[model samples]
Target: MKGIRFWAFWPVAYQPSSLQASQPPSLFGLIGRRMTKGQRRKLNRIYFMKYCSNCGQPVIHRTPPGDDRPRFCCESCGMVHYLNPKLVVGCIPEMEDRILLCRRAIEPGYGKWTLPAGYLENGESVAAGAKRETLEEARAKVEILTPYALYNICHVNQIYLMFRARLKDKRFGAGAESLEVKLFGENDIPWEEIAFRVIHATLLKYYDDRRLGRFSFHMENISPPNPNPPKTDN
Candidate 1:
């Protein structure tokens, strides 16, 4: 479960060329000017099986290596495949001075708490994704308050957007993805049992922002720890 979640939600990091020049090159780069055509082809084949980041289609084959660049051709839509970040959206919904949270019933963080969140669906706006996740996980309607936190999980390669929201009514229950649904004041939140670093960070930010009566948005990159972090899903 942890492995699956790590691959699904974590962000992948690429060292910038400028940064690389300042430090020792990786073993692969040290041996060559660039990835060899054969190496790029192999990488492309692996990438295609992971699906087209653009159209969600399984890329059928590697494109002919061209100009020493990696390329893949999608079979479903004939689109070129290029690695890109996937967008995820979530919301922290507040009602009566408490924040809504869900206990995930699925792995990576089974039994751990999280804000309602999931990947953005095709043709959906970020806000729509947030709303949909809220409904899907908590069975509640909420009004978006403001942008909250934006984070890049670079270990697996995902961009997360969290929105501050106000519950339309104090009416919600556990939905498909959740084992339980409840609200918690800051002091009562299960800090050590939270699902992910991003969620923990977001909750911290929310508390600070609420106390100051000031709302501001920020972004950060979160790296997963080595040796496989503990699972939080129920």
Candidate 2:
């Protein structure tokens, strides 16, 4: 456990193999309770694509004429329904030496700490989405510094992209989607309350690069059965 240490971060998200001591937080592990709306939504990709998008028709699960993967094919219309991973965009907003974090207003990790990130809405660039999320959750403007981390949570079909940003001012408060928002220095980060592994991984990388006086982009697959999908809009 002593050897497994990471600089704590709020999630935009985590990956598994990087740690020897910790596993991703699981909503199911908390208790053998029913899945929350947030948890259930993560699996919506599997169950929700019941109709064809191109034409309003019930879809059938089958491997279409030539495709190797099973798709939701419309019997009435020739359209196939394909489910893809959801993209979440956020940023590591920094003020002086502190970083901003939001207490989730929604579940699977309700009340947990996370970076200011959410699903990228249609017609928005990655950079725009990241900056918008920061403002929406933390109520703060920022100067996006650079792209920082990208995490793929295959099990839950989510990809989180996080950026490095400079907070425009210190006058931020919790947004409507957040319970509370706060800033913390590196050592003061709330590791146990962290919302996702991807966020944690991104934070560790941020501090490492800061110490080296150089920030570099990172990409990693946040391994399987990712149970801590945010209940928020993402």
| TM-score of each prediction | 0.70, 0.74
Q: What are the lDDT figures for the candidates, one per model?
A: 0.77, 0.77
**1-234 in candidate 1: lDDT tens per residue?**
222211111112221221223233343352323454544543333333446677876554333435234344565776765667889899999997899999999999999999999999999989988999999999999999889899988666799999999999988999999999999998999999999989999999989988999989988988766657688999
Writing each residue's lDDT as its tens digit, candidate 2 over 1-234 gives 324323322111011222123222462232223455555454344445545678866665556766776566677878767778899999999999899999999886899999999999999999999999988988999999888888988877899999899998888999988999999999999999998888888888999998999999999998765458668774
Q: Give the per-residue Cα lDDT of candidate 2 at 144.
A: 94
Using TM-score as the measure, which candidate wins?
2
Model 1 scores a C-alpha lDDT of 0.77
Segments in model 1 whose C-alpha atoms lie over 4 Å from true places = 1-69, 74-79, 228-234
What TM-score, to 2 decimals, does candidate 1 have? 0.70
Where model 2 places Cα greater than 4 Å from the true spot, the runs are 1-45, 225-234
